[model samples]
Target: MTDDLRLVDVESKHLDDVYRVRSRSFGLLSAGDREEWLSDVQGFIDDGRIVGVVDGDELVAAARIWAFQQWWGGRKVPMGGVAGVVVAPEYRGRGVGSKLMRGVLARSVEHGYPLSALYPATTVIYRHLGYEFAGGRFRYTFPAAELRSLGGKEVSVRRAGPADAKRFLELVGQLHAAARISGPLVWPEDKVAEWLGEENSFCYLAEDGFVVYGWQSGKLRVEELVAGSEATARALWSVVGSGSSISADVEAYMSPDDPAHLLVNKEADKNTVIEHWMLRLLDAPAAISARGFAPGASLEVDLELDDSELAANTGRWHLSVSGGSGSLTPSTSTGEVLRLGSRGLSALYSGTPLATMRRAGLAWGGATAGDGAIDTAFAGATSYMLDYF
Candidate 1:
């Protein structure tokens, strides 16, 4: 919120210049040898997902967002994912970055996303702006020597073409619907086109029709994996499991529990876990409503989100949901409420246990009343995300 800095919308025409600015700003690649970078930038532009900041005639900063499907916690909610936030080094400390972020976040709001998710380069910087560490991802080392073999009816896998777009997306959407940690399933048409345009990137389907489970593999990595059931998930894993080049160090994200610890493979060792991304709920009602839930009757909870960043999300509210669909409304009663700020809420939102939140001194309110509600909200649920934008 600086007076001098101004925000501008970037269009397709300015993509090359924006990438040049990004490259120069981040030292990503040698100047002028940026054909691939330009191509990636153009893809975002073509998808109608890139936004830029201009200082008069100069493009000083740029950010990109992509609309893709991800597992939220068992339901797929439309998410505005922020990425490629780059500001020219010369303008780094001049409030240009904040202006660029304000513009993009505003656009995200305009786009009707309940939340904005990003993997920030620096958590402290984003935290001040209301972003919170929502969750962490785990990289599991499924040792090649201990890799399990597949059995029980070989899944009929077929290479999918452009004609299979509808089927692929539909099946993936169904698979993510029951996932405990999933994101939006609507694929921006342009991004799909870009993924399909590549010769080495292969999309695979395993089923007779619409119910098929699907995945996409890039040249050196099995980038995306989605399936309707645990069996289907295992079948898809079998496909990637056959490849020895993937390294014993297999990687996955948005997984609620630590995958390294969850895996039964005794040989899988030297596991690594680290905080990967942060998420900010802009529309708490919409976001809380969008999440899929286990069986629950009703619970009225009050949340005081951060004022600096989640200014609109602050204040007390009541949440009621049965099955999976729910509603959040302003609370009228202060009686028997579970009171907590955005920090405590963020820790809980990111898969931290209620007891852990209390133990860490990050939570407030009466423990006896608050603990039960917090535990109920997160019970049998988990979150998972992917590193793709």
Candidate 2:
């Protein structure tokens, strides 16, 4: 009976059971991607990052947590990237899914992740669990011939592979920090190596940047393209669009305000898809301390925050930001302080304007005077991500 369902660590032997549930919940598990999936899931198991819900011998629900360092205000903070959630259809209406995610969140906090984020299959459950819309993964498309015209033919580009992973990350760190980029993530060396070495992907390296792209549904899809200079940016775009004869269009994961868009000649309005992602603070103080603030921003605000899912986060807090860094401390408020739900604070952390949050009912309280300053403290580039998981 479902009443006997227990939350436990998933092991190698329980994989088939987990896969069965995944198939039932998400559809057929294709053989082509199964080997990679097994290897990836096994790595999570080895790292003690997999959590599951079981009834006797069957896994009724499961979720995987990825240890990721996500960029914010130009710095990276430890974040739990939750993914691959599944609950057998028959068990969906019960509390099993919640149980699995709660266990996962606890594990994430235990591992000292200050934040958690996910590209949701459905927002309701995670919203109930404390995640709020933080940012997006935007795919902007362009005619292949158009990208080709953003010439960098004078610049040199070289083929890159697994060995270039470290350099790739170094470039990313340099670019993101310099630009004060927000909301992208950097993978560990091994994961970066694995992605670079994928045979189907076209990987290239320039003096200051790199690009990874591959064919998908007759289109050249750019998984990631990070460039630190105008020349490198032009070089990468040209290389990806070089496949114009065979692929009429190109799709890339980038910010809505991406530098590449500057050279694209015209507005690209077709085939754009924005996938929203949710985030929450696992350790509110830590999350704030790690985030970079606008260098010119100055703010001192007290928030009466409520996190229904995590008791440690529910209370009054004094948030201060200056000199491109921030701090959050527990404090008593003498007046009706600004109040926010966990979701509201997270949305603000990712630079959502305070006025928008209030209208959406994500925030409230009589302390409305600080809205402009709070918004400025968190404002910068629009939040976005390149990688899906």
TM-score of each: 0.78, 0.95
Over 4 Å off in model 1, which ranges? 1-3, 11-17, 28-57, 145-148, 153-155, 183-197, 202-204, 208-220, 227-236, 241-264, 267-269, 273-275, 343-347, 358-362
lDDT for each residue of candidate 1 in 1-389, tens digit (9 for 90 to 100): 23445666777667766867777757667555677777777787776677778766667788987664445556666777898899877788777777787777777777788777888887766765667676555444454423334321366666666667666666656655544554333675555656655676556677732221122242223446555544555555555555545455334432434332333355344545554777766677787777765556355566544455556677777767666556778876655455555556655555566677777666655546556655666554444454544
Worst 10 residues of 2 by lDDT: 262-271
TM-score of 2: 0.95
Per-residue lDDT value at 302 in model 2: 84
| C-alpha RMSD between model 1 and the true structure | 4.6
lDDT at 361, model 1: 63
